[model samples]
Every structure is written in structure tokens, then in C-alpha cells.
Target chain A: MTEHTLAEHTLTATDLRLAYDRREVVHGLSVAVPPGKMTMIVGPNACGKSTLLRGLARLLAPVGGTVELDGRDISTIPGREVATVLGILPQSPAAPEGITVADLVGRGRYPHQGWFRRWTAQDDAAVNEALTATDTIELAARPVAELSGGQRQRVWIAMALAQRTDLLLLDEPTTYLDVAHQVEVLDLLVDLNVTSGTTIVVVLHDLNLACRYADHLIAMRDGAILAEGAPADVVTTDVIERVFGMRSRIIPDPLSGTPMVVPESRHRMENSA
Target chain B: MTAHAVVAGVRRRARLTTLVLAVLAAALLLLALSVGTAVVSLPDVLSTLAGQGSRATDYIVLERRLPRAMTALLVGAAFGLSGAVLQSLLGNPLASPDVIGISAGAGASAVTAIVVFGAAGPPVALAALLGALLTAALMYVLAWRDGVTGYRLVLVGIGLAAILLSVTSYFMTRSQVTSAQDALVWLTGSLNESGLDELVPLAIALTILVPATAISARALDLLAFGDDTASGLGVEVRRTRLALLVCAVALAGTATAAAGPIAFVALLSAPIGRRLARDGGPALLPSALTGAVIVAAADFAAQHAPGLPQVPVGVLTGAIGAPYLLFLLARMNRGGHGG
Candidate 1:
């Protein structure tokens, strides 16, 4: 594979407002993603964490303010140009029936190619590397329809990796996976970040996993950021109560040195007593 | 089982399928040309096509069957390409032009022109083209909530198709018996009166639209992943869809104008092509070739099948395709993926 030069990318949203029809989903939110770091957005259901990710990926146009990439308004850049710099994997993308994993991953080369450019060896190398990185090289020849849920998710991540972009955004990449597979997926992302210095942002539902994997943490509620900082600083009992509307005890994870939330529920309290 | 090996295997299979389909289409075309009343031999057909044959052979091959055979090939290919494009664009195998009211729109308009306006030939074809375009626009408008989803588009198309079919039936009921009989033959999609005038316009349309379809094949493949994924992959989803829709309508319209919506060839060709190639992407060239082979073979069967009365090729295709469609619907209802 041709070694792609890593360009510095900065993604920031200012006063961003998003809506589906007339009903607003995300209202006037401003945040900047730390460059070359793994940032995780965590929030409860319907809090617009996915919507914020969509805005950053340019999948949804902001209703009020602007999202900027390196100080230029992102909406102004042509889609293909933006695509070469940023890669996104939506929450749940359907695979065409009967498509092999390699062929599906090769689609990530779309932005790097033109009508006449066709497929080249460089593309093949990129695809092969992505598959290898995701540990999906063994499943490359299998049809996507035949893969397990975890395998399919890895194949999708490999597709995004093949884009070879400086910035990658994933919306709930670990959903629908077993605990082992979820950690496996997150570990793959960490490897990518450490080796390639690719800036990564993911919207995650699992609070403990988010804390364990995030270099920078963002907690959100009602489409607004409640707290943002390192996991240790941001994962306080008060912040968790404010953000999730649930009282929780914060404890250090035995596996990782990050704060893990232990929710205080009636059933749990009764059992403990 | 390496990625390269798998990709190469698919490519090889697709190429082999294309070659096989091309040869089958050619053989069927020759059979259709040679096996009519006053049965000419293959040699005579070839000589006549090369511009040196007996007067009888020349009149039989060049003046009569060649135009019909060529019309079958071109119109069928056009329909196939259009169907493949639509199916991939909407991410539903059921989104063929015939099912989604494009051909119905053309058929409705052409029937109206023939019955109400007493129109024949080129004017009817022009009417069909306009009708198909208008119906596509209307379907897009009706299906658009925020954006057109495959499910909504197919549902809206089926509704429009029902309305157009009723309009066509009403027009037939109002026309004179003789005029209605003429419209009936056209409606059943016979290759009986296929001539150079009809063939040339469809040929021109295919020449332009076929290349356009080829160019958009990659985008169509990406679109199967849904609009958000496709857009994230750098496909200009809306623009690509609009361009593809226009191409699909023009192709289906031109084919309908020529042969009155030869039933289900478009609907059947892509899936068959995909199966033959064993590839997941939109098999444009393979589908087109498969369609040509199907129509040419169907026309031959319609003309020469023993103990069967003379019938339009459309009747045979519809008889064959409708059962398959039902089977598909049953499977989908039983929890198979419909889209």
C-alpha cells in the first residue's frame, strides 16, 4: 500500500441546531473534537448523540450554525472532497445481498477514485490492510449475508478504514455485539488510533465501555453537552445524575483505571440490603 | 479464499455469463429469423444478412423477420438495463419498471393515443415517452416525505400502476371494435408489425441510455447500502438517483413505445443475471444480455411452439413471470428480505 500522508484535521461544531421536520432534535450545541484523540459521546436514549455525530459527518445539515473542518465551513466543501478527508460509518448500514466482504470493503475506495481511475493495486493494498487490521482477512472471501453480527460489524469498520481518511466518525459501532466482541471492536479502533494517528470520534451507548475506550469524554443531555474532559474528571456522580437523570456511584474499573458507573436502582438497593 | 481470489472468481463468472448470454441471444435471434413459414436455413439467413441471397430468402429475412428480431433484442435489453438500474437505486428487487408504473404509464398513454386520438405510429410513441416521464415525476412527488425510501416508492408506484391500468382499460372500452383490436395487439406486446421506423428510435435511445446506465452502475451498487452510507462513501446520492431515474424512465418508455411493455422481461432479467454471475453488484451488461436472450427466445417460442395458437411474446412472458412474482411475494411475506 502506498503510505498515505496524515493531514491534521480539526472538526468543530458551533451553535449547531438540527431537526427532523419541524421538531428539533439537537439545539444550539457547540463543541470541538480534540485532534488525533479518541473522543466518545455518551448520552441516554433520544438525547441527540447520534444527531450530533450526523452533523459532524455531514450526513445531516445543521439548521442554525456551522460545522467547520480546519476553520472552513464543511457544508461549503464539495462532498467528494470532504469524503477523502473524513470517513463515517453510519449506525446500521445494510449490505447488498451476496456481496463478499472484500468487495464490500473495496467500496470505501470510492472517494479516492474517479470514473476513469477504476481499481488499482493501491486500492487492493488498502483493502487488504484494512481487513488485516480488523482481523477480518480470514473472512474476506465469505459472503456478507453469511457472517455473524460481530463479523459483519468488523467488516464495516474495515470498509471505513480502507478510506484512509484523517478523521473517522462512527455512530454506535459497538451496538448489537456481545461484551467480548464490543471490547474487541474498541481495541481495534485503539490500535488504528495509536498506529495511524487518525482522529476518531464515536457515539457510544455503553457508559463503562465509553469510559474505558475514550481518550476524551463528552457527556450529553437534551442535545447539549453536560460535561467534557478526561474520563476521570467527567465521570462524577453528579455529572452522571445530571446527564442520565439517574443516581449513580462512580468507581474505578478493575480492568482499566477509568471510572465505571454503578447505577443505584431500587432492585439493586433492596438486594444489597 | 483470499480476497483477490474471490474477486477474480466473481469477475470470471460474470465474463463467462456475459459471453454465454450473448451467444444464446444470437442463436435465438437466428432461430426467430429462420424458422417462420417458408422455413429458411441458417446459411440462407446469414447470406441474406450479408446482402447476397435468393430473392425469397432476402424478402423473408431482411424485409420481415430481421426487424422484428432486432426490435426484440434492443427493446428487451433496454428494459433489462432500466430494471437493473431501478432495482439497485431503490434497493429492492421488486422495483422493476413494470411493477413501479413506468411501463404502465407508457402503456396507458399509448393506449389513450390509439383509442381516443386515433393516433398510430410515431405520435403514440411520443405520447408514451411523455406519460412515463410524468408518472415518474408524480411518483417521486408522492413518495417524497423527507426523501424517497424504497418501501414508500414501491408502494406509491403500485398505486399509480393500478390507476394507470384502469385508465387504459377504460380507454379500450370506449374505442371502436377494430381500433380496440389493434390496441389489444399492441397492448399484449407483439413483434408482429415491428418495422425499421419503430426499431430506429428505440435503437437511438438505447445507444445513449445504455452507456449512461453503465456509467452509473458503481453509484447504484453503493446505493444498496442506503442513502446515508452511500453519501458517506462520496456518492452524490440525490444527483445520482435523479440521473438514474431519468435514464430508467427513458429506457422503459422507449421500449414500451416500441413493443408495448413486453411483460416481465425487465423484472426477471437482473435477478437471473445476478444469479448467473454470482456477484452482488448491479449486473448491468449481464442483465441486458440476459434480457436480449429472454425476449428473442420467448418470441421464437411464441412463433413456433407446437399445439399453441399464435400469441404475443408478452403473453408468454407474463404467464411465466407472474407466477415467479407471486412466489417471491410469498417468500417475502414468510420473512425473507423484500428489499
Candidate 2:
């Protein structure tokens, strides 16, 4: 299951414009994903973060400009060819009815297959490796329908892992998970980035978790990027307030010394002695 | 279990189910040929099929029994494959072609060709194919807002079916009695007049369509989840959908043109095949075989049943399928939705 060190793949969007029907959601924007780093895109609801992720993953076509993968126009490339080096896990993807965990994860090997489907030992090895990485090996025989929310989330991650892409994108991977499970999923992603050198990008809802986990941080508001750098540089009070429209105090995490946001809630301020 | 082991197990089960269904279909085919007023013995029937029989036996087997039985099997397979494709692609159990009025669309078009243009043969078959495709496209447009949902698709299909059925009826009323009889047979979906005129075209259509469906339909398992997920997995989602949809519509159309819109053969074959195979996935091969068995058996009964009068093959399928449709709607309602 050992992967050779991946060649740095540059994923970039230049003056990208996105729209739903006629009303433009994301204005012309440009950004480059840092190769081999854990980059997280954080913003409030409908900030076009998910839309940008969709365009980056080639799930949505851009209305203007281009998204280039390794200096080539991504849309010009064949879908299966692109899928070999880049994979994305969309938020709230559902499993087919009564599908076993192993079978669902096995679907991640789709791009690598010929039109005449033949499941090989190599595919099986990749699936088994992914199940192990996501700590879902025990549930491989279980139906995805019977799994708990957190377990199911891990199973989905395992499916993405089986794809073995050099760069992976996820949109709101932890939207419905509780605090502990969210942290667990993040830690698992970090391990993947560190061990396999996968270029990882995520759209996150939780500010503190995004700050703590991301090596590179991008702050977005109103369909445009406001700041991007290390967590300490881009996650300041002004950016947080502008992005989320909330007041907050920035503090160092005691455990990791990462920049963490302590939201100054109205209840906290007025009720304190 | 190991992942490959699991895959192997699923494959084994699918293969085993297909083999069993094939045997059952073959046995029924033999029975269909042997049973009648002549009561040709199994050996004689076998020898006749092998092309080594006397002229009298040859006449009965090839001229009389073979075409009818062949029609039943081919129509069953076409509808079975078409329904499996629709149900899987739309991610709805109730989205069979007939259930969604695609059959009615084909019926309307073929009738229009017959009564209005005085057309027959290949022209009528092409008309049916065009009709089915247009109706499916219409249903998609009417039902689509942001994306299609199963309930809305089914509802839109029923509305389309009603309008198309009325078109068929109007054409029937305007035509002469002979043409009206033709329209009536199509409207009711009968196999009584099935012959080489029907069987040859239906067989050729399936021969082309089935392989095309087999290749394009590989995306179906991925598509069953959602469009986003399917595209993410490297499937050319729109292109794949269009190709598979066309194959299904053409199959349904040609079969309808040949057999007069055999009802419920497409509808029940899928679930029955899935259940029989004991597989949760599409079980497409099993579904096709299940369809063949249903039609062969239904045709046999329609011809030979002691108490009942001679009826069209469709009458039996409708009697079985109509109730299942109600039960499915009731259950889908209870479950809230499929999409």
C-alpha cells in the first residue's frame, strides 16, 4: 500500500466566475492551492466556498476563466484521467440501498477500471488499505445503512482514500458530526496529508477546528478571498468578524499553540460578573 | 471479510442466479413449444428444434409455436432490461418505462403512424422508438426544476401518459374498423397476432440495444447515489445518462411496436428478479430472465387456461402489474420518497 512520493500538482483557478442559472454566485476569483499542505477554506454559509470547491473538483463548470491542473486546462482533460490524480468527497453523499461498506468503498476505484469491469487484487489491496487507514476495517462487512453517523462518515472517507488521489478536496466534511467526531475526522485527514503527502483542501464551518488543523488558511466572504496564509496571519479578529459577521477574541490553543477563536457571545459579555 | 472475497461472493451470487433463471426460461420455452392440440412429444420437439424433423412437425414448431414463444421471450427481455435501466438511473423503484408512461408514448406514436400515415412494418417501429424518446424527454423537462425527484417524475409521466393515451384513442376513432382493431390491440398490449413481422424486428432491436446497455450501464451503480457523486467518480454523468436513456427508450419502443405495449413486463421484472437473485443491486440479467419467464408463462396460460377465455398476453400481465403499482405507491408514500 506504500505510495511513491507524488509529484507536486499545481491546482489553480484564474478569474473564475460561477453562477447558478443567471445570478452570479462567485465573482471572478483566482487562487492557487499550496501543494502538499493541509489548506482549509472557511467562511459563513453561502459565502461561495462550496461553489469554489465544486469548481476546483470539476463538479461544476466555470462560466468564465479557467481552472488549470498542472498548467493545463482541467476541463480539456478527460474525466477519468483527472480522477486518477484528484478526488473529491462532497458533503452529504448518500450510499446505494443496502450496500456493504466494502462494496461502497470499492466504487472509489471506478476511474482506474476499464469499461469491462474486473476487480483485481490490486484494487482489493487499495480498498483494504483505505479501510485500515480510516479505522473502518471492522465494519467492512456491515451495510452502510446500519452504521452510525460517525461510522458512516469514516466509511465515506475510506472510499475517498481508496481513490488514492494525489490531491483531495472535501466540502464541509464535518457538518453534522459532534465535536469529538469532527476532531477525529480532521486528525485522520492530517495523518493522510502527512504520511502520503496528499495535497488536501477542505471547506469548513467550524472556525476553531479549521484554525487548529489547517497548515494553510484561506478566509472568504462575499464570494471572494479576503486573506490567505498561515492560521496566525489570516485568522485575525478583523477577518473573522468580516467573514462570519460575529465578534470574537483570538487566543492561542494551550495544547497546540494554534490560533483559536473564542467567540464573544452576547450572553458571555452581558452576563459575566 | 476480505474486499476481494466480498466482490467474488457478489459475483458468484449474481452468476448463480442468472444460471438458475436461464434454466427456468429454457424449460418454459420448451413447454411453450410442446403444449397444444398437437401435443408434440419432448423428443420430437427437440428434434424439430434441431432441424431434423418431418415437414408436418417442422411446420407446427417453426411456423406456429416458435414465433409466438420467441415474441414472448424477446419482449420480456427488452422490457426487463429497459425497466432495470430506468429504475437504477432514476434511483426510484417505481420509475419503470411503462409505469412512467414511456410505453404509452410509444403506443401513441405507432398508432399515429398506422392510422394517420397508413404506415406499417419498419416505419411503425421507428415511430414507436421516436415516440418513447420524445415522451421521456418531455417528462424530464416537465418534472425538472433544479433536478428531478422520483415522485414528481412519476406524476409527470402519468399526466403525459394520459394525454398520449387520449391521442391514441382519438386516432382509433378516426380510423376504419380494421385500423381500429390494430389500435385496440396496441392499446391493450396484446401478443395474439405476434409473428415474424413482430419477432424479427424485436429480436434485431434487442441484439443491438442489449449490448449497448450493458456497456453504458456500468455507470448505473455509481449514478444510483446522485449526479454529483457519479461525476466525482469520473463518469461523464450527462453523456452516460443520455446514452443509457436512449438505449432503454429504443428497447421499449421496438418491443412495444412488435408486441403492442406489453404491460407490467417491464414493471415487475426488476423487483422480482432482484428478489429471486437475492441481490440488492440492479440484478439486470436476472431481471431480463425473470421477464422472459413471466411472458412465456403468461402467454401459455392465456392460450391454454381451462376456465378463462382466450385473452391477449397483456391481459395477464396487467392483472398482475396494476395491483403491484398501487401497492408500490402506497408503500412509497409511507416511506415518504425515493429521491
Candidate 3:
């Protein structure tokens, strides 16, 4: 295995205005990603949570404002150079048909290669390490199409891990996963964050899981931030009601003592129950 | 540890398959050079190639058979590589250059240049190249809706193909019968008139385009994960795509200019190559080799088959490819690939 040094990167979006065709999705949103910490963004569906993540990662161009990485405009940086510092895994990325897990994961080395550069020993080491880290080493020889859903998701995560970027962004990485698999994936991210001090950002649908895993939490609604702070400070009953538009109670998780939200629904009233 | 070994194994298998296909193509090429009404043997063909044959043998092998075989081989390779590139880029098995109207565009312009302009040689070739590039540009424009997906491009190409074929038929009907006879043979993709006029320009184009494609194809792999993931991996998505599409269009156009759009060579090569090499990635080199073998064998049959009328090489390939297309369509309808 190769030695991996802890990495530092500061990514900030300043008044970002992102759009798809004619409709602006994320409007004038400003946020700074806390370096070396795990940040989670949560909100209701179609509220531009994913769009903001896309803007921060430079996957979608901001129509109105600039995003900066290490205090420089990200658009000015060469794509491969930016890729070496920051890796992003979009939700539901498809693997090529008949591609082996190893080959699919090995493609993450694209950023490190040039037109003249062939595969090297370091690339192999990185791929091996990624497979081992994701516990997918045994499945490396198998066709990706043949893998179970949870295993395929792990392989995608392994591919992202192989990028070895300091700033890693994932957009709803836990979709299509069961409750157990979701926790497993989140735990894996925590391990990466703790071990390498990688600045990690995640867009999550599960608000409670977001609160449990995040060192910094952000709640958004209608393309604007409702609250941003530590999970305990940000995931309040009022904040949840405002962001999610549902009456909710905030309670401490029994296992981790993290803020947990219990949303009140039609059947939760005393007479209905 | 196991991953490295596994990848190395797969690479070895691909290399072996490519070598085997190359040898097969070479063997078929020699057979094409050797046999005809002349009844020359392998040694005679090899000796003729080495400039040691008797005058008659030399005339038969070098002056006549050699040019046609070389055209068929190179044209096949051009169509094959073009198909492999476009299919990988679009992420659809049926997204070959011929199926997507690039070949039709080239043929339509070549036919027009022949019938309308009374042109021959280089002028028609230029018109075909321009037509292919313009059609590709038009397709990209029409398919653009925020962005062009593979599905949209494929549909738009099919629509354009219909229009281009009509333009070809109209020109054929309005022309003199003698010119129509000439145009008809070229439109059906015969190599009877193939010579240095076609071969030199094509060879030069391949020398440049093939290497460019090999370099850009690295990005094509990342694109299999979709545009956002590919961009996140540091590919300049739009630029890379445009470069590849340019290569695909130019290759198809050049080959069509040379041999008048040989039916189904572009549509057939990549899938056959992929299955032969068992590669997950687009087997471009292998496809080129497979295409060379297909056309060389088909042309040899056209030239030397006893008791059979000599048909154009395109007829044999069209017969094979049309059925395979129907099979593919049926399979797609019954599977998740309907879209």
C-alpha cells in the first residue's frame, strides 16, 4: 500500500446562482465548507440542496457568481488539477456494461494520467487500496453488472475513494440503500474523514442521519439556508418545521446523543393514535 | 493484490484476441490478392508484391487486385473505428455512424456531386466530407435541448437519414441513364473504381484520426459513468465530446467518399469485435481488424466465387447486418434497453 498524507483544501461558494436551462435552481447561495470537517446538507426534495452541491463541486456552472477553491476562482483552475484536489460522486452513476469492478474503479486514476502516461505501479496500488478500504477486494474480478445493489454501491464508493482527493463531495450517496447499508456507507465516510482529515460534504435525504454524522449541519428550503451550525444547534423543532414544513419534535438519539427529529404526521395526534 | 492480477489477465486476453484477429485479416487479404480469373498462387502474389512477378502476374496483382483489396481493407478499418468511437460515445450498441445517417449524408452528397455537377474524383470526395460534417453539426444543433443525450442524437440522426436518402433518390431519377448507372454502382458502395485517388487521402486521414481517437477514448470510458461523473473526473466534457464526434464524422465521410458508403460495415464491426475480444471497453483496434477481415473476405467472394454472379461486397454485408439489426431491435423491445 502507498502512504496517504492528510490533505487540506478550502472550498467556498460565493453568492452562487446556478440554473438548468431557463429555470434557476440555486439562487445567490453563499457558503463556506469547513476544512477537514464533515458537512451535511439536508432539505426537502427539489429544494435545490443537490443543485447547491453541484455548484460547489463545479459540476454545474453558476450563472451569477463564482466558486473558489483555496481562495482562487474554481473556473480558472484546470479540470484535472481541480480533480486531483476534489473528488465528487454523483447519485446513481452507471458502470459500463460488462465492466469488471476493478476496471471500473481503476478509471478513477484518469486525473493522474496524461496522453503519454500508461498505467503505473502507483495506480495499481491505489486501486488495490480502494478495493480493500471498501471491502470490495474479493469482488474485484467480478463483472459490475452481476453485483448486488449494495455491493455495486460499494464499488462506486471505492471508485471515488481511488481518486484520493482531499475534498470529497457526495450527492445523496445513500439512495436505494436499505437502513443498514445507509449506516454502513455513512460510517465509511466518517472513517475517511477521521483517518485522513478529508473535508467531506454530503447531501442526504435522511435528516436524522445527517444530524448524526455531520460535524457541521445546514438546513435549506426553497434555495435558501434556513439554518447552519452544529447539528444540535441547527436541527431544532422550529428549524425542522420551517425547512421540512412539518411539525417535528427534536430529541436526543439514545446511542449517540445526536439531535434526532421525530416528525408529527396525521396519525400521530392523541385521538388518532 | 488480486485486482492487479485480474486486470493484467484481462489485458493479456485482449492483446491475444487482437493478435488473432489481425492474423486472420492478413490471411484473408493474401487470399484476396492471390485468387481471381488469373489463377495465381500464394507465392505468385507474394512475389508480385515483392516486385519479382512476371509482367502479367504483376499487372493482375499489383495494378488491379491490390488497389481494390487495399481500398476495401482501409475503408473497412475506417468504418469500424468510426462505429466503435460513436457507439462508445453514445453508450448505445446501435449508435453506429451508418445507422445514425453520417454515411447517408456522405452518400447523398457524393451522388449529388456525381449526377448534378457531372464531377469525378476529388471534387465528389470533398462534397461528401462537407456533407457529413454539416449533417453532424445540424444533428447536434437539433438535438440540443440544454444538452444532447445519446437517445436524442440517435433519433435525430434517423430522422435526418430519411431526408438525405430522398435527396439521393431524386437526383438519381433526374439524371441521364448512363450517369445514373455510374452513380448507382457508387451509391451501392462498389470498389471497382477504387485506386490511388481514393487510397492516398484516406491513408493520410487515418494516420491522423486514429491516434487522436485512441487518446480521446480514455475519456470515453469515464463517460460511461455519465457526464457529471466524467466531468468530476476532470474531463472537459464538451470539448472531448466534440473532438470525438469530429473524428467519427470525418472517418465515416472519408470511407464513404472512397467506397461510396459500404452497407453495414460501420454498423457491424464494433459489436462483432467486442464479442470476439470479450472486452468491456470499446474494442476499436480489434473492430478495425474485424472489419478488414469482413470486407476482404466479402470482396474475395465477389471476385472469385465460381458459378455465382459477382455482386458488390456491400450486398453480402447488408444481408447479414439487416437481420442482426432486427434481432437487436426485438431484443431491445423485450428488455430494459427499449429507451
Query: In DockQ terms, which candidate is top?
Result: 3
- Fraction of reference contacts reproduced per prediction? 0.66, 0.65, 0.77
The model with the greater lDDT, 1 or 2, is 1
Q: Candidate 1 residues B162-260, lDDT tens each? A: 999999999999889988998888888888778998899988888898888778788888898888898898878888998998998889889998988
| Winning candidate number (lDDT) | 1
Q: Candidate 3, after superposition: displacement of residue A71 in Å?
A: 1.8
Number of the candidate with higher TM-score, 1 or 3: 3
TM-score of chain A of 2: 0.96
Docking class of 1: medium
Candidate 2, pairs of clashing residues: none
Model 3: residues with Cα > 4 Å off, grouped in runs: A1-5, A271-273, B47-58, B336-339
lDDT of 2 by residue, A44-150 (tens): 88889999999998999999989999999999999888888889999999887778888889999998899978888888889999999999988877889999999
| Residue A92 error, candidate 3, Å | 0.9
Prediction 1: B-chain TM-score: 0.96
For model 2, the superposed segments whose C-alpha errors exceed 4 Å read: A2-7, A270-273, B113-126, B140-152, B173-178, B278-280
The DockQ values of the predictions, listed in order, are 0.64, 0.64, 0.70
CAPRI grade of model 2: medium
RMSD in Å for all candidates: 2.1, 2.1, 1.9
lDDT of 1: 0.89
